[model samples]
Target chain A: MLILECPCCGVSGEETEFHAGGEAHLKRHSVGSTDDQFEEYLFMRENPHGVHFERWRHNNGCGKWFHAARCTTTLEVFGTYCAQTYEPPKEIKDAISARRPGWSWRNFS
Target chain B: MFEAVSALQGASFNAGIAEVRELGLRGMITLRGDLTDKKLIKAVKGIAGRIPEPRTVALKDDDGAAWMSPDELLLMVPHADVLSTIETLNASLKGTHFLAANVSDARAVFEVFGPHAREVMAKLAPVDFSPDAFKMGMFRRSRLAQVPAAFWMNEEDAFTVVCFRSVAEYMFDLLSIAAQAGSEVDAL
Candidate 1:
């Protein structure tokens, strides 16, 4: 079991109590961006093999949503923070805020 | 057609007393939304006729209790009242930002009562069940055997344990384990 550190609670808990969000720091494109740019934005994900920041829900515990920075290769969590306030990758954020088709928080936030 | 299941069978553990017979419990509804949503607040108030006072569980005229959470609440009412409650809520809600779903059938509840019930729960859950910490008319989101569950403690040493129906059987097994643990503790 992965021991996740909650930035809010300041405690490390089992991964079952938490959920993995996704790559952090997505950039939003400028308005009137082309379809190719939009497609690239939609399909491209930072497949980082090392430390990555993602959102994890403490659903079984505080029932509060938070973010976790962890290593996908090792399942080693580096840090955590609240989800809403956690900064997202500029591209992903722009796509999400733009309300573009295929852009979603569920797949990447 | 419905029968009351004992604590060891399917009883809800209360905090103040040993036990009280519960015929059937209300369906459990988990309402999730931003606490600052005025429209959501208005809708909930309209349906339940005012949310339960802060930190306190108040029942509707029909014996439904709305237990508040940090960002949401767990509402308990008779299964029969669920449909009407949802309809009234839908009519009152102004936006689609809020999500309200009836989870009564999704959860299995067991009422565990008795003076020792609290003690039994302390061993099972990580939260403080003492009156000061848990008190009367408070709800908690906690884990049982690492499974998500909502706990509502009412007066008379009575508490209701609600969890997903899929894990209800597992929780039941844990309760039996807790009861046996209680029994063992008593022996020593």
Candidate 2:
């Protein structure tokens, strides 16, 4: 039973209470964009073994969707933050880096 | 017969282990807005007598105000007063970026009252219903045996569970089975 603490509702519960959305922090492709860009945006996902970011909804709790930084291999969740932001918050990045010394996610190092 | 009838219609089971009854014709108003906004809070307070905190419920007589999500609140008022409540809310927060809808008939509410109420709930949901963790006024939207339901405890051994009107029968069937003979074990 994987547990996630919801940033919006402040309730921590098992995976049954949440819905997982694979791979976070991807650039959205829109109309008039290159075919390759559009295809990548629609189908591409980074299932990295080490540090990774994700989108999750506290579906059974707050009904809010948020982002989480976790290790794909170890399943070690560093932290969760607001989904409204374009990128992971600095604190979440710092938390990931503290555990994974050389790890980086998407645009944030 | 053009009269509206309750989903349960006085049908109950489990030999009084846990009694179930429908709260018929409840007036539900779905309010969506920024809870932190003073105007919104004041407007909600005007109807519910208090602003509910996150995952918390405030009860004033038969009226219940619950925080459904970060930006959503559910107000349960008397069936007769629903229209007036909506009008008052619209007048109160006239220019706010909010959505208010009357959802009275959209769902059905079942009240579970008995000593084994929490135990029966624990059998269906993945949440912990122990006194220390899940206590009074804590409202949560969770699945009860794959049916999306929301519940809140107003008394120590009593709770109110709501689900879509379409699935009320399925929900009752599941609960009835769970409350049947030999279901009351010491632990799950």
Candidate 3:
């Protein structure tokens, strides 16, 4: 069982308590945008091999959704943060950088 | 023309009552607010005898407040006190952005006790139920038999399990089977 720590409740429980909500920090291309842009918004997703960020809901636990920064290959959770924010915190990014040097994800380095 | 009945009212289980029993008609309320607010803390402390914290259960008078999340609590009282409890919480925490609602009928409550209680719970959930890990006053929200449920370790050998009313019967059945002697499994 994959253990996940809920930032809201502060409980680190099994994956069964959480629901993966796909990629995190996506820019929404909306109404006035071109069809290609809208399609990218709806269909494009990053399948990263190393450092990645994703959204997950602690549906069975605190019932709060949060962001998880993890390594895709090794499943090492760099950190977890509240989902209310638009981007992962700078310290979390720095931690990732310290572990995996010179790695870039989207706008973050 | 009708009255509400418990999920296991007429059902029978082979296991002894000392190990487990249905705690019917509990007054349950889902309370949401800012825990850090001084007024909110004092208000909840007035109601449940102490400020509730995440993963812990606090008792006030005869009521017990089980922590549901960072901003949510499950307050359990006698069935008759349900309405008044909501009113008290609202009155005490006025002006703050808070929500207090009675959900007494939405779920069923079961009390598990005696020597084999931990073994029974182990069969169904993945929670840490050992003495050092899951102690009295600690609560956990997780799945039991693939159904959403929450359980509180209320004492040394006692715990409370609450599940949706619709699936209460199934939950009771699963608990009964798990309660059988020697049907034990390891829980983390």
Top candidate when judged by TM-score against the true structure: 2
Model 3: lDDT to the true structure: 0.83
User: For candidate 2, lDDT tens digit of each residue in B76-148?
Assistant: 9997798999999888889888888998888888877788888888888888888888988788778898888
Chain B, candidate 1: TM? 0.74
DockQ for candidate 2:
0.71
Candidate 3 chain A: worst-modelled 10 consecutive residues by lDDT: A1-10
| Number of backbone-clashing residue pairs for each candidate, in the order shown | 39, 0, 1
- The digit string of per-residue lDDT tens for model 1 on A1-109 reads 6787555434345766566655555445558998877876677776666555666766665555676655567776545656665365465344334543343332454
lDDT of 1 at B150: 65
Worst 10 residues of 2 chain B by lDDT: B8-17
Off by over 4 Å in 2: B14-16
Q: Candidate 2's residue-wise lDDT over A12-47, tens digit each?
A: 777888999877878889988999999999998776
Best-fitting candidate, measured by lDDT? Answer: 2
Could you tell me the lDDT of residue B86 within candidate 2? Answer: 92
DockQ of all candidates, in order? 0.20, 0.71, 0.85
Q: Judge candidate 1 at residue B10 and give its lDDT.
A: 36
TM-score of 1: 0.60
How much is the lDDT of residue B73 in candidate 3? 83
Compared with the true structure, what per-residue lDDT tens digits does model 1 show for residues B1-188?
A: 98633223434433222342332445667777765678777766655667665445565565554544556666666777787877766766646566678876776776666666676676677566666667776666568766887677655566777777777667766765676532534311
